[model samples]
Target: MNIYRHEMRMSLRSMLYWTTGMLVGLLFFMMMFAAVSEEASVINLIVSQFPSEVVRALGLSTLDLSTVLGYYGYVFMFILLVASVYALKIGISALSEEIRAKTADFLLSKPVSRNVIVTAKALSVITLLALQSAIYSLGAFIIVDIITGQPYDKTVFLLINLSIFLVGLFFAGLGLLLSVSIKKIKSVLPVALGIVFGFAILQMLNQSLADPVLAYLTPFAYFDIARIINARAYESAYVISDAVLIVSFTLLTYIIYRRKDIPSV
Candidate 1:
């Protein structure tokens, strides 16, 4: 319990910063929807002139930007990217910090076993993420309501926002697995950004290529906002894929973290 509280306290500031940034950015984007809606015809005409491949790669192909939901869908892509980064940073740093700070010896010298340590840290990360998701979702809901001043489909909005949480979880799992497997992570930000952006780039390529196989390779492609908006629910296949990724990586993290030797300080 001490470990869990410590870990959460350590990450609390970071979580707050990310939450504030996302909230402000989302609200600002939502506010712009009105201006965009006022000039929808002109904006659509300009967007139509862009290459179809470019539009698709941007995740704007199937969306109608005039509606609040459609604008939210487009903005959701950026939100997911930022949220993934936040999750990746938390996961990568959770275990690696002890090693990086040369404090693993101190931590391991305690009465608790390594498994307990890991469990506590993992729980802390999960708690932080849950808080972030809930706050962001609530803020988005309120902002959208204020901006649109019309009733939108609550079911669809919830599903679309849920993708942010799921994607964050996937990246968090990936980060944990990588942190355990790698010998050292000199700096968390560069590696996390590289991995997140690399996969994001692959997603863009997959869209450009229209390749079903490539789509499976990137978590960013796992939740299609267009499909979610259209179906009013997440696609079953991708949801299953997300589950698989999260479960597989989480198990692997525990296995490797438990068995791996901590370097002597």
Candidate 2:
């Protein structure tokens, strides 16, 4: 419980910053929906000039900018990217911070078992992730309603936004494994950014190639907005993949963290 509270206190401020940024950015972008939807043809024409490969890579080939959902889907990628970074940072820093701060020895000296410590820290991060997602979802709902002032597919809109949290789970789980598996993480932000972007790039390439096998490798491809909009649902295969990956990452984290040495200052 102490560990959970400590982790939450440490991360709460940064979570607010990221959540605020996403909400404010979403508001400002949605405010332009009217203009964008009006002139979507010109924008589409300019975009069409690009090669189909490039268009597909950007996920622009499928989404129609004239519609509210399509425009929201396009911009939602930015939110996913930013939120995943914060998630990865939280996951990677959770267990590793004790080592980075040279307090691992002190923490280990407590009466609590290693498994209990891991549970507390993991729960804290999960709580923060849920809280952040719920807050952004509410803010996004209000922003879309006020900015568009027209009825849209509320279900699809929600699924698109829900991707932020689902994809975040993948990143957070990977981060936990990385935190325990790696001997040292010199700086959390750079490590988080690099890993998140690397997977993001892989996702873009997978889309460009239109490869089914490659899609399973990256979490970004799992809750693809274009695919979601077209099918009107999340793919069961990807959802299962996400669940399996998260469980695997978490289990590995527990095993490695328990056996690994914690050096003293």
Candidate 3:
């Protein structure tokens, strides 16, 4: 309990500045939606502003933002990707920063074991993620409603947001695991970006490959917003698989971090 509290304090303190910045940045994108809502052809107006390639790259083609699911999905993805930037910033530093700052020596000198330390840090990261996602999603929802004069199904909104939140935690685990394994922060960002983009690209490839089976290979491909929104149900397979994979990876990270030796700079 003490370890968890300490880690939470440290993480919140370290992330206070970054979280504010992300919220402000996200507000810019939300404003775009608010502006377009006034137009009769709201969807087309929003789509027309972006280049075809830009739209395709961002997965906008797969979404139709006029419907609640589509709009929520579109808005959700925008906010998620922007918020991920902050997550990666923190995740890359979770372990490496401690080592680099020479704080690990002092921290590890404590009575708590490595597993406890890692667990606490992991929990702290997850908490911050949940807080950020809720703020952004809820804010977006209210803004959408205010501008459009229509309310979304509260149940569906929460369900979809929860799914997105789970996916964020999965990546958080991945980030923390990487932080423990890799000492250098410089390379972590590129690798993380690569992993994210790679998943997205693979999802796009599934379209031309015409391989429904291959769709399961990419996390981004699963839990699609359009399908979920139209059907008004969660994708059980995606939720299950994502949970399993993230939990497995987190466990693997804890084991490795416990046994690994910290190197001196």
Highest lDDT among the candidates is held by which one?
2
lDDT of 2: 0.90
Residues 29-140, candidate 3: write the lDDT tens digits. Answer: 5556545544527667677799766666566676665554555567666555545556765666666777878788888888989888877777777888877667656765
lDDT of 2 at 212: 95
TM-score ranking, best first: 2, 1, 3
lDDT of 1 by residue, 1-265 (tens): 9999999888899898998899899988888888987888898888789998998887767788888888888898888889999999999999999999998999989999878987898889889888989888998999899888977789999888877788988988899999999998899998988999999999999888889989889998888878888888777887898899899998899889889999887
Q: What does candidate 2's lDDT look like per residue over 1-265, in tens digits?
A: 8988988888899899999999998988898899999999999999999999999999899889888889988888888899999999999988898898988888899898889888998899889899989999899999988888888888888888888888888888999999988878899999899998999899889989989999999999999887888888999999999999998999988898888888657
Q: Candidate 2, residue 2: CA error in Å?
A: 2.5
Q: For model 3, where is the 10-residue window of minimal lDDT?
A: 31-40
* Candidate with more favorable, higher TM-score: 2 or 3: 2
Cα lDDT, model 1, residue 260: 90
What do the candidate models score in CA lDDT, each in turn?
0.88, 0.90, 0.68
Model 2 poorest ten-residue lDDT run: 256-265
Pairs clashing within candidate 3 = none
Itemize residue pairs with steric clashes in candidate 1. none
Candidate RMSDs in Å, in order, are 1.2, 1.1, 3.7
Name the weakest run of 10 consecutive residues (lDDT summed) in model 1.
55-64
